[model samples]
Structures are given as C-alpha cells and as structure tokens.
Target chain A: MSEKLYSISVEVNGVARSAHVPARLSLVDWLRDDLRLTGTHVGCEHGICGACSIMLDGEPVRSCLMYAVQADGHRVTTVEGLANPDGSMSVLQDSFCKCHAMQCGYCTPGMLIAAKGLLEANRHPSDTEIRAAIGGNLCRCTGYQQIVDAIHDAARRMASGAK
Target chain B: MKSAPFEYLRADSIASACEALRREGDSAKIIAGGQSLVPIMAMRLVRPSLLVDINEIAALKFIAVERDAVRIGACTRQALVERDDALASRVPLLRQALAWVGHVQTRNRGTLGGSIVHADPCAELPLAAQVLGAKMVLRSSSGARTLAAEEFFTGPMVTATDSSECLEEVHWPVWSEPRTGCAFTEIANRHGDFAMVSAACQLALDGEGRCVRAAFGLGGVGQTPLAFPRLAARLLGTKLDEAVVKSVAQDAAAQTEPGSDLFATADYRRHLAGVLAARVIRAAQEKAGGGK
Candidate 1:
C-alpha cells in the first residue's frame, strides 16, 4: 500500500526546500527524486554503503537510514554543496581531482563527504585514522590509497592556508 | 522495501513522549536514532501504526558524571560514546563496545539506549552494560523506575519495557579503585558487521595484586548477553595465574549455549569465546596490575 504523505521543510545546501513525502520516503529519496539534487548516490538500500551519505547538522550520516521528515528544520549538505558560491571546487574536491582519486567516481561524493567530516574534526589525522574515518564508505576502485592521500593533502593545504 | 503507513509525532519532552506511547499503546513505536527502527521498518519486520520520534527531546541526550555513577541519556548517540573522554577513562568496556555497534555513520545516528532497547543478543553495548552493572531508567506516563541490566533484558528483543514505558537513561556505577581495568573484544566477519561472538570483561585487583572482583559478559552466544558470576567467583581473591585464567575461560565457554548461525556454528563459537575470553581477561588483569 502507498504510505500516507507528510510535509517536510529542510535546508539543503543553504536553500530552503519543501516537499510532500510518503512516510516511507528516505531523506535521500526526497533529495534525489523530489528536489532533483541527485548528487547523493544510493549504493545499498541498507546502511552498509555510504553512497547516500550527507551532513546532517554538521555530522555525516547515512541518508538512506533516515526518513525525510527527520530532516525537517535541519541543515543538510550533499556533495553538491561542496562548491563555492562562485562555483569553485572545495579544497577537498580539488585535492581528489589533483590526486586522481576517482576511478569509477561512483563513490566520490560519499568519500568527499566522509573526508570532509574527518578533516573538519582533525586537521591532521594519522594514516590509520584517515582509513578508519572512511571505513564506513566502500570504494571498489582507486585502491583507496589515493583517497587517503587526497584527504591528507587537503588537510595539509587547509592548514597551510593554501587557497 | 518501503515502510507501512504510520503517523509521525516528534515528542518535545520525556513526559510527552511517554504520554504519546501511552496513548498509542502497542500501535506506536518509539524512534530515537532511527538506525535500528528504520532498517527493521524497511524490511517489514515490524509495522507500527504510529512513530513517536524522540529526537527532539533534549533531556534524553546527555552524558554526566553523577556523585555515585555515570549517567548516560538513552538517546545519546553511539558515536558520542565512542569519542567521549569521560567514558573512555571511566567505563572503557562500554566505550570499546560502542565502537563495534556499527560503522561510523550508523554509530553517528544510533543511540546507546536504542541498542539496549533493541535487545539484539549480539549487540556489544548491551553486553558491556550488563557486565559493568549498569542500570536502565524506564519512564512511564505516570512516573519512572529503574532496573539493573539483568532485569532489563527478559528475552531476545524483549525487555521489561511495556508499551507505556520509554527508556530514559542508563546509569553506570563509577569505580574508585585504582587497580581496575576492563576489556571489550568481539569477533565479526567485517568491521561493522554483527558479531559472531562478543565478550567484555572487567577486573579489579586488591592492594596485594590479587583479583578482588571480576565480571565477564558474553553476547551472540545466547538469547541475551549472559553474565558469568560463577566464573568470576572462581578468580576472586586469587591471583590470575595461567591455570586459573584458563579454567575460568573454559567455564565461560561451557556456560554459553551459543546457537548455530550462518556465520558460525555453536561449537565454533564456544571455542572462539574461550580463546577471546582468555585473551581479553589476561589483558584486563594485566591492565589492572594484578601481578606482583
């Protein structure tokens, strides 16, 4: 049976968006299907994969595990929110490209968001901490070493004030 | 994989949440972190007609050190527990157990209270709480009450929590002893996957470096996280000699009636539990400085 619908108002990437969603509608679905912000990927319907990762109230969470209503009045940042207002890549995004960390690029958005969460908390995480931070997000390609390097490089660049 | 139709109500306070639960009775389910509830809903394992989301209740999200105990609000996220300094120094077993609950993202959204209430036999935090002598606070519309860890879990996914009751907080008694150490160890196929067998142990040593008290709890081995006081008694007031530790580990293995699953057979689990228990208990004893 089609679930009953609920109205939700959320701030996505600094934009206020409103939508009518089914009670079963995941926040990821509302962002992709309704708002047309398709940057968030859906790798696993369950919480195992981080393709649907997003920053909820400044902490990265699996959007697939959260209902759309849970995002009401909360700040959500997807990969699309990574660019500057003038559309320049975030230091993290540029680092990923410079390091050629993306092979399939399917897991880039989640990897970037996960890295963003980590780099915000720790400007200089050890190799083990960097690996542990992104352990939740699976990357089938790039051997993951490049992603680790990208995060480290970005952290160093950010700390060095290299714009 | 969609959840069935249900009315959503965000509770603003504990009284309101309990009132909502009382109003909806068994027809409604409480959602804290939604990590456990959302997946179970998508899988159609449970279909409640109403969902009382308690995310807005600020009172149920705290980690405080009371005079006699450390009080953790039930809605406190598992990630918070993993990073909490007070918990690390005060309740290492609980802190270590928090790391194995799920992945970083799941832990970011999952709550310690939710894990306990979910009552999964393999959940690490519950077993850790059991071994540490933690108490659970259960609130009803009319009033509130508390239960020891053993009294909290009556069966698999079954708690003494009634439809009208909501879990408010968990209290862990603080240890003032200088020579006490705890260890949390689990065996899982993947880092974030459910455990095949998990165990937590806490050891306290007297001034003479003899074991004064020992508490061991095992998960994924029974209908609940089983506590082994009989085994702990064997080592109390005695030095943790290899033979004594081995005997206690053997007793722990024998005590577990671990069921066979797709991951591990009951026999294999018994063996793993013995090895891990022996290893962790020795480590904990050493950390407690139990040897002269």
Candidate 2:
C-alpha cells in the first residue's frame, strides 16, 4: 500500500530544495538518496549513532530521528555544507584530515558536522568540552583521541585566525 | 528499519492538536521532538494510523518562570532546558538531570514534555518530575485538566492521559529556599546511555545546617520512578549525617521492585540504588551546606 506524499521545501547547504516525501521517509534518506548528498552516512538507523547527523538550523541533530516532512520549512546543513565557497575544506574538516581522526572514514561526515556545530557555538572548547561535544558520534577507530585532537587543533587554528 | 507509513499532521495549536486527536480517535499518537517516538516507530513497535505532529505548536514551546514554579511548555526541547540559565537557576535539578539524558543530537530534538510523556522506567525527566512534584496539564478537545507527577506517571511508558488528551505543559515547582542544592546521578554502562540505576535529590538546609526540606527518588529500579516522601520526611530536623542518610536510602532501595536486565542484575540495581541514593542525599547536603 502506498501512503500519501507530502511536499517539503527545505534550504539545505544554502540551496533551496523541494521534494515529495512519504511520512516515513527520514530526513537522512532524502538527503542521501534524493539529493545525492551521500556524505552523511547512516550507521544506526535509530537515534543512537550520530552517523546521520545534520545541522538543523545551525545545531547538530540526528537526521534519522526526523522525518523529511518535519524539515519542510527548516534549514539543514549536511557535511557537504562544511566547505568554503571555493570548495576548499573548512577549518574543522581540514583538522580532521590532518589529525587522522577517522581510520575507516565511515563516521567522518557526522563527526565533522558535530565538531562544526561545537566550534560554531564555542570558538574555544576545552578538552573535556570537545570530548563531550563529540561524545554522541561513535568512531570505532582512532580511539576518539584523534577526534579530540582534531577538535582541539581546529579550535587552536581558529584562535590563531586561520579559518 | 523504517517506520510503517502513517498520516501526519503538523499541529499549529493545542486546540487543533486535540481536535485532530479526537478526530483520529484511538489510532492517533502525538509526535513531539520525535526523538524516542521516531525510533520506536522505526522499530514498528507502534504503527499509529495518524501521527499528530505537535512540534510546531508555538504555544507549547515556552518557559515561564512564575513566582514559585517554572511553567515549561511541553515542546520545550531538552537542549533548551539544558541551556536555559534562568530555568537552571530556579529548578537546578532539571538541568542536572538533563546532562544524563541522551546525547547532544538527541537532546537537540527531544522535548521535555515528550520525555516525561514517553515515561520510560529509567528516564531522567520523569524522575526529576517525581522528585520535584511537577504538575502536568493535559488538554483535550473538550477542556483541560492537571495531574501531579505521581498521578501523571501511572506505569512505565504508561500515563493517566487518555487517547484524546495531549500534555500541554509541565509546572516544575521551584524551591524558594535560599540554601538549596540538588544532585542527580546514575550508573550507565557508557556515558549518555540509559541508566542501570539512578538517584536524585533536592535538599534545603536552615542556618544551623539542619535539613528543613528533602525530596529524593530512584529510577530504573521500579515500574515507575519511585519517590520517597515519608522516608524523606524522616530526614527533616536532622543533620542528614551518613548514618541517617544511609539508613533512609537502604529502606528506600529495599522497597523498589527492580527488574534484572543484561546491563545489571536486579540485586545489583537495588544495591546501587541504595548506594547512589545515600551518595546523592549526602552530596546534596554537602552542597546545601556550601561544602562544594
């Protein structure tokens, strides 16, 4: 049986996008499949893993926990949005690459988004704060040490006016 | 896994949400924040024919610090609850308990009303509500009614709310005492995971370092969050020394009907309940006395 489809208009990655999605279509699914923003990975389809994390109005939230219809009028920032206008890597993204934060690269997108969300809110987060900020995003590899180092490094880079 | 297909309606107001609930009848479920409900839905545990979306109800997303209570609208996000300095200053335990909730991503979407209404046996919000004697305002198509946290939370994930009633807001009473302190602690396998057992308490001490008012409770050890009013009353007029606190905590823990799970045995949970309850009561006492 087919359910009714609802049309949603969302500003994703600074671009206006529209789609007809079923009520059960998660925001992550639409971003990954419909819009081809495959940077956001789906780890745990449930809310536990932050693999499908996206910035909903500048705050990182689990896209898997939200339906596309729920994003009808909101602005979303996927990992793809964490880039300079010239397609260069953002400060946090570059820090992740420099620090070898992800071993397998599966959780990179979500981790970048989470770290971006944190650095946006707190320009200079302490070690404990960085650990807690990325606590939700599970990275089996890198022992989370590199992720912490990457966030701290990004904070330092930004502090030195190296954005 | 994906959720079963269901009709969705974004409610703009409480009356309309109730109107939709009454129209949809028993097959309708309210979706707030969609943190827990979405996961439960994705697992197919529940497949409501009509899912009423109350996240857009602006009236149901507010925090009003009243004379002696903080009236929090049901849709106020947990992230907001965690960040609100004013709410934290008044009802400090609310903020303390929020740190033990789900991760940052979930908290960004989870709502205070949704958490309490979801009413998990081990959830932090309901335990805080119970410990604070929070009041729930339920609204229906016909009218509105209020219920205390004791009456509101009937069982694990079960509430006194009927099919057509939606929780409008929660009234968390703010302790007016000057020398007040609260502590919320839980034992989870991982940081941000569900608790094996949790304990929280709010204490007020007079000038003589004597307990004037006390309320404490244990979660994840019973069908519902268990609050010990009578045992807490036993704390009044005492200095809440280790002996008295431990004795009261042991009694409170012994009364819990904890269930054994993979993470912890029932016996272990009961023991932790006793230990944590005593620990928090003492910790709150110390804080009230400006110990830390």
DockQ of each: 0.69, 0.86
Error of 1 at A84 (Å): 2.0
Writing each residue's lDDT as its tens digit, candidate 1 over A10-99 gives 999999888887777888988899888899998877788788999998899999999999888899999999887899998999999999
After superposing candidate 1 on the true structure, give the runs of residues whose Cα lies further than 4 Å from its correct spot: A1-4
Q: Per model, how many backbone clashes are there?
A: 0, 0
Tens digits of per-residue lDDT for model 2, A39-158: 999999998879999999999999999999999999999999989989999888899989999899998899998889888889989888888888999888889999999999999999
Instruction: Tell me how candidate 2 scores on lDDT.
Output: 0.93
Q: Candidate 2 falls in which docking quality class?
A: high
Which pairs clash (backbone N, Cα, C closer than 3 Å) in model 1?
Answer: none
The 0-to-1 C-alpha lDDT of every candidate, in the order given, reads 0.88, 0.93
Candidate RMSDs in order:
1.5, 1.0
Worst 10 residues of 1 chain A by lDDT: A1-10
Instruction: Provide the TM-score for each candidate, comma-separated.
Output: 0.97, 0.99
